[model samples]
Target: MKFLLTSGGISNDSIRNALVDLLGKPISESSALYIPTALYANPNGPAMAARLIRGETNTAPFPDGFTSMCELGWKSLGVLELTALPSIDEKCWLPLVKETDALLVEGGDPLYLCYWMRQSGLADLLPELGRETVYVGLSAGSMVMAPSIGEDFVGWKPPTGGDRTLGLVDFAMCPHLDHHDMPDNSMANAEKWAAGMPVPAYLIDDQTAIQVVDGVVDVISEGHWKLFTQE
Candidate 1:
């Protein structure tokens, strides 16, 4: 599966272009699934989830250039709540996933998202997805793709009790770098966070995103980003 791991949602033209390239079609012509399960694990999660699904943008305290994932105007957009999948039959949702052009996962808690992805069977099903299917992730959604989110980003602990994630990609990420809303995400802190990571890591602002296709990784940014490799 193709990956468009982003610090923010589709916030800039470059990121949008990368997403379209991954889709191999226009956004208006494609179908997508919005996975907002991660949001539920955050503070005021339910309210935030509602706003995100409703495509409400420019809300206060969300950083200057925050973008909503669902407002992109797709041919069709459906919500695939990972938390709800476990209670339902796989046959009912697996086909929906296979048919969608992309999965637009929202930000919240990375570990929480990882936990649900495993429990909902999505983690196990990822490798079987078609190569053309794009996985668009925002913040924690993107972080969950890494081998580990590092201890600093851990919020919701899974039963397994570790910062480990899906490991879909080789590197970990620190999103919203230097954004005033998140003082803890400053570069110095990101550098400290990267120092403890066993793999390479990225420190990206809202305008940046990392694109991975067929195992090749590229930085698609309208703002700034830094890739740190361990010594």
Candidate 2:
């Protein structure tokens, strides 16, 4: 699988170019399914989540301010909404996933998103998607792809869901590193958190991305990032 995991979603030209490249085509020719499942998370869940709710997350068409990412100077973007996993069937979202050229997962609450991703069966279905489809993630969107969601970074703990992610990547990512937008996210905090994780942990800022092509990892960024592991 291929991924363009950004801290703040397409922040600059470099990130945009990478995303377009990952799409294997111009943004104009490709279509994307914007899954804002993370935004739909309970706002009161975590500290960073609360700040997110107050920030760009409240924006329309995408609570996480998807205008820049979706606009991509390209084709149209579609929104996928599912309030309750059990209430909705696969037919409602599967067909849309099949037609899109990419999947744009927005940021919010990782725990909240995971619950629905699994409950709706999308989690299982995601691995089956064709290699041609790009998996673009922003903030919590990117974090959920890791083996587990570390609460120390965002403090957004699930009321009931487990920390285990889709495990698409072996490393746990702490997005928006040293970002003033979210005060809770700082270099000091992230480094401290990364030290304790079982797997490698990457702290990436808004201008940075953790790009994964087939299993190889690359840190693409215009800002700061750190990869911490037990030596």
Candidate 3:
């Protein structure tokens, strides 16, 4: 599966273009699944999820001040709540996932999202997806793919201890870098956070994204970002 991991959702033209390249078709022709399970672990999560589904951009938390993921026009968009999947038969949802062009995952709490992904059997299915499927992730959605999120970003802890995540990727990420709303997200704090990480980490602003095709990873950014290797 191809990955379009963003600190913020397709906030700029460059990121959108990269998404199109991944899709190999116009946005209008693509079908996507919006996973808002991560948002439920956050404060006002339900309201935020509603706003995303409705495609409302007003008072959006993103640095770009734009609707993060769900707003983009697509031929079809459906909500695949991870929490609900465990109760249903796999045959009901597995085909939908395999058939979709993309999965648009929202942000909130990475740990919570990670837990549900595992519980819902989605994590195990990821490796089986075809190359044509793009995974578009925003904030926590993107963070969940890393080896770990570090203690600084931990919120809803998993039942099993530790900051470890899916480890789908080799590195960690400190997203929303230097955003005014998140005062603790300064470069200094990011540096300190990276110090405890075993793998390299990317400090990325909202206008930045990490694109992974096969195993080749590339940074796609219109804003500032930095990559810190373990010392």
> What is the C-alpha lDDT profile of model 3 across 1-231, one tens digit per residue?
999999988999999999999999999999999999999998889988998888876755653556557778899999999999999999989999999999999999999999999999999999889999999999999999999999999889888978888988888999999998889999999999998899999999999999999889999999999999975
> Model 2, stretches more than 4 Å misplaced?
42-67, 153-162
For TM-score, candidate 1 versus 2, the one ahead is 1
Clashes of each: 0, 1, 0
**C-alpha displacement of 164 in model 1, angstroms?**
0.5
lDDT of 1 by residue, 131-227 (tens): 9899999999999999999999988888879899999999999999999878999999999999999999999999999999899999999998899
With candidate 3 superimposed using the best TM-score fit, by how many Å does residue 51's alpha carbon deviate from the native? 0.5
Mark the regions of model 3 whose C-alpha exceeds 4 Å error after superposition: none
Q: Whole-model lDDT, candidate 2?
A: 0.74
* lDDT by residue (tens digit), candidate 2, 1-231: 579888888877788888888888899998887776677554543443334323334443333323345556447677775455568776776887877888888777787777678877878887888888889898888988988876563444556645777788889998877765566778888877888777999988878898888889988888888889878
Pairwise lDDT winner, candidates 1 and 2: 1
Instruction: State the RMSD for candidate 3.
Output: 1.0
RMSD of 2: 4.3
List lDDT for all candidates, in order. Answer: 0.92, 0.74, 0.91
Worst 10 residues of 2 by lDDT: 59-68
